[model samples]
Target: MGYLRLLRQRPILVLWSSAALSVLGDRLYGLAIMWVVYEATGSAVWMGIAAVVESLPYILIGTFGRGLIARFSSFGALGWLDAGRAVVACAVPLLWSPGQGGITVLLVLVLLLGTLGVLFDPNLGGLVPDLVRPDRVREVTALLDLTNRIAVIAGPGCVGLILMVVSEVQLFAIDGVTFIVSAAAMWWLRAHTHRVARAAAPGAVTAPARRAEPVAAWPVLRRHPDVAVAVGLHGIGFFVAAVSAVGLPTLLAVRLGQGAAGYGLALSAVGAGALAGNLLIGNLRAGRWLTVYCSAWTVTGLALIGYSTAPTLPVVLGVGFAAGLAAPAAAVTLRTKLAGFVPAQRLRLITVDQTVIRTAGTVGMLTLPVAVDAAPATTFAGAGLLLIAAAATAAATGRRVTAAAIMSSREPAGSQTS
Candidate 1:
């Protein structure tokens, strides 16, 4: 009650609640959709294709999506985008089969879902700090991380239980309703309007109004060496996760003959471990970005290689726990970097750039089936090698660059106070 009273100074609770609701539904539908596709066709290749379709849109609209967030109201853009996701999620069941029409429809829907997701994150990334106390950013981020892990843990298990009775279509429809409910909540959230400044002074110059504010994000990033390095390292780190996240699930369920329930159960271990790590070790004042970030990613890569050879449920579950714990810690550090760089108004644009980086790793995931086919032993080994290289490069470059600037850096300046 006391914390709620403090947070009540802004509508951070209401907005974050809406986020939790929508993301929970989104994750549930995602697990259901992936398993349903694998079930219908029994094809690992299509699973990879579906994963590609989902991430490819962010690659395509990476810049344009950022521009939209920067140009419009974050609340308005994200609310409508979440509503739009509800519409597309409903159509997922219609493409459950693996025939020509089924694959095409499913791929199309994946594209739509991914595009909407690209729009969703940037707007929301810019929105969150607006609602919370600035000093509480690490706290809010940790809570949000915890919330998302809870969703991942709970959601797949829910789908596993539901799959015993209802069809995937029913699950998809239920997810749609959840999104609609979430969007309604978001629409009602009392966020500080971006246009308030323009309204107050009528002379405020927005990002778009400034002719010098360019669209090329690479240059924007270059001005801040540490931030650019961090973002780039995030892109590389995602490759390791892609293989583990996308490849392992398919390998377990579709290739190994463990049903979707088995796959979800193993993944839930990941969510559970991540929830524990973030809650326990990822305190704002305790984390050592250089040491923790480097060692964690190295260990995560090794775990992925070990997972490729996991023969039993116990091994996979153990690997999942390690990977999940390390991955989120790394992600938290990158997000902290994001908070320090760009202005609050343009953070949306930067998030779009982040989406692009993740998509690059998805491209690696898309190639997994081909690699698996070529040399089963070699593929996993290659992923491990790449992971080490990426972590090494980032530690050598980004960590060193930022260490000197740590004391001086702060979250972006904005119209509103923390």
Candidate 2:
């Protein structure tokens, strides 16, 4: 069958569509967010805080929620979370009145929005294998990567234009409506019956027997050393991701004096770069060289940090694109590896792994603004340090992970018994 026929057979395309919808809102939210905060408080500090609130908390949330999701059906949990995100995304745009327009309100709204995000991501990832064929996981992930790239490029651009034309309320309302579409699409997904990839290992798990979910990240990861290392290495990419997403843009606009548009342009470059990366980079034939992926993002963060001092749009985009390229490749690699290491039953926890990867990025988001605001030009150097730390930690230990994978291919132990 053709690839299009494969997409017709599964929920992945639909789920991927849902992701694209949310990402459009996600980008719009980014544009709207910067505009509202920058225009409202007139402080880059507020912008910093808003970014932090949106991205930072996921680390602990995913780290802890990994347990909670393990208990419920990943699909059920995701559906409810998707519903909640839609409600919140809808409500946030309405949170404005002359008297109510305080930094406090924006901060509160961001907090609420961030809280919902914590639940949404992992559950979404958990749905993938349940949706697509095993052999095609990487291809599907790459496609999703491409979808996100488009969203990143389009979100801010559309929102930026909307801000020029309409009121914040209307832009926000549109964003909310997009969320409604995204959530509704997710609801249409057949959660219970999506096909799983790992159903055929020797003593492979049968559908009926492996229903009891494992609760903690450690338990599942402990047995799967390979995946655990992949998660850590993925965190390197995440660390760089945070830097590019939060640290560089703020530094460019505030310290470099390029303003919000500069920041947006720089990010769009990263998105464009990532789209290019997905197209150009593939083939898990040398998958064990996970360090190469870590190095890619580390270079991204470091280069971006250095680019912070440069006063050119093209320079910013160039650096951002390199980072972007590394980011998605890292993501594609880790997700593909996770599919190999995990069972059908542990999809949610695996999703949590993806979430936690970004959660690490969130940690960077939390600190980056303050660092940029306080030190101005030098904060990016701090980002470089963060990226390097993540890279070195992962690189030093990734071989152990590769070894485990080698062992798994020899004999898959986590295979479920029917």
Candidate 3:
């Protein structure tokens, strides 16, 4: 069958579509939340507090949510989480009122949203390997990343036009509707999978049994030391990328003396570059992944440094585009490798991988002010150098892992699991 035919027949397309919808709704809902909170509290401090409330849970989940993720299969975890988020999104607009108490309610809803997100994001990624054939994993991942980037680009671009047509409440109500679509898609995928599994095992009294003694997240990390090191380096890369995402606009607006237009241009350049990079990466073979990841990170760091030292807006924009281009190589390679390394049987690692990188990114974002206070250029240089080092470490350890695998068998790393 053609790739397009395979895509249409798989639940992965449903998963991909739902993720895009969720992202769009999330972007719009975030804008609505900020506006409502600011209008109610009239204090930037309260807004800051709201932001913290929203972010803290993800960090907590990254550290602790792995065991919880292991309790249910990835699909079960994902479908239920989507359903819960849909409920909260719908309730936000329905239950909201304009008062101090309304601000309190918003805070609660944001916390719930974050909590659901903590479980949903990782588990959803974890589910991909199980749902699709091993050969298609990389392709599915690339497609999913492509969908997410499209949503990220469209979400922010459309927010202004969307807000012009509807009140904050009305916008959130629409956001709720998207969540409902996402939830429904997930449930449908679940039912379809169950049916397929049943058909595959005709006359069997029951479906395949769940793992009787599921291992914990830390042990899985311990077992795969190379993956652990790679994951750590990946987390650092994430941190640098997250910090840059916030820092670039400030550099453009405050330090470079360019206004909103420059910041917007730089941001769009990053997204566009990332989209292009994903397309480029899809063509590369699996054996070349380690090289691609290392080179991408190393160059991305250099690009970030270039952006920091650039004298003109155009130069900054170009450098930002370069950084974006390199960013996804690490993401695609590491994610595809990790999915293969830790199969559906050892599901704990999915949550562990997602949570670690997410928490690290959040920390990087939160540390921005400190970096800025010390020196903006110095911060960029530090982050860039860290990424270069991470790439080197990943390459070194990845070799050891590959060598070990080769000694053990003729099978390639991709064939060892899943």
TM-score of each: 0.77, 0.76, 0.87
Point out where model 1 deviates above 4 Å: 1-10, 35-43, 91-99, 191-215, 246-268, 281-284, 287-291, 305-319, 342-349, 373-378, 399-418
Error of 3 at 27 (Å): 1.7
Q: Which ten residues in a row are the worst by lDDT in model 3? A: 206-215
Predicted candidate 1 versus true structure: per-residue lDDT over 213-290, tens digit per residue:
225666555555555665666676775555665566566764466777777778888888888778654454645565
lDDT winner between candidates 1 and 2: 1
Per residue, candidate 2 scores C-alpha lDDT tens digits across 73-191 of: 45545566666766666676566643335567767777777776766655555556546668777777666766777776776567668778887655656667776777666656633
| Each candidate structure's count of clashing pairs | 0, 2, 0
TM-score of 3: 0.87
- For candidate 1, what is the lDDT? 0.66
| Candidate order, TM-score descending | 3, 1, 2
29, model 1: CA deviation in Å? 2.4
RMSD of 1: 7.0
Which candidate tops TM-score?
Answer: 3
244 in model 3: Cα distance from truth in Å?
A: 2.1
lDDT of each: 0.66, 0.64, 0.74
Candidate 3 deviant stretches above 4 angstroms: 1-5, 42-45, 74-77, 206-213, 286-288, 342-346, 397-418
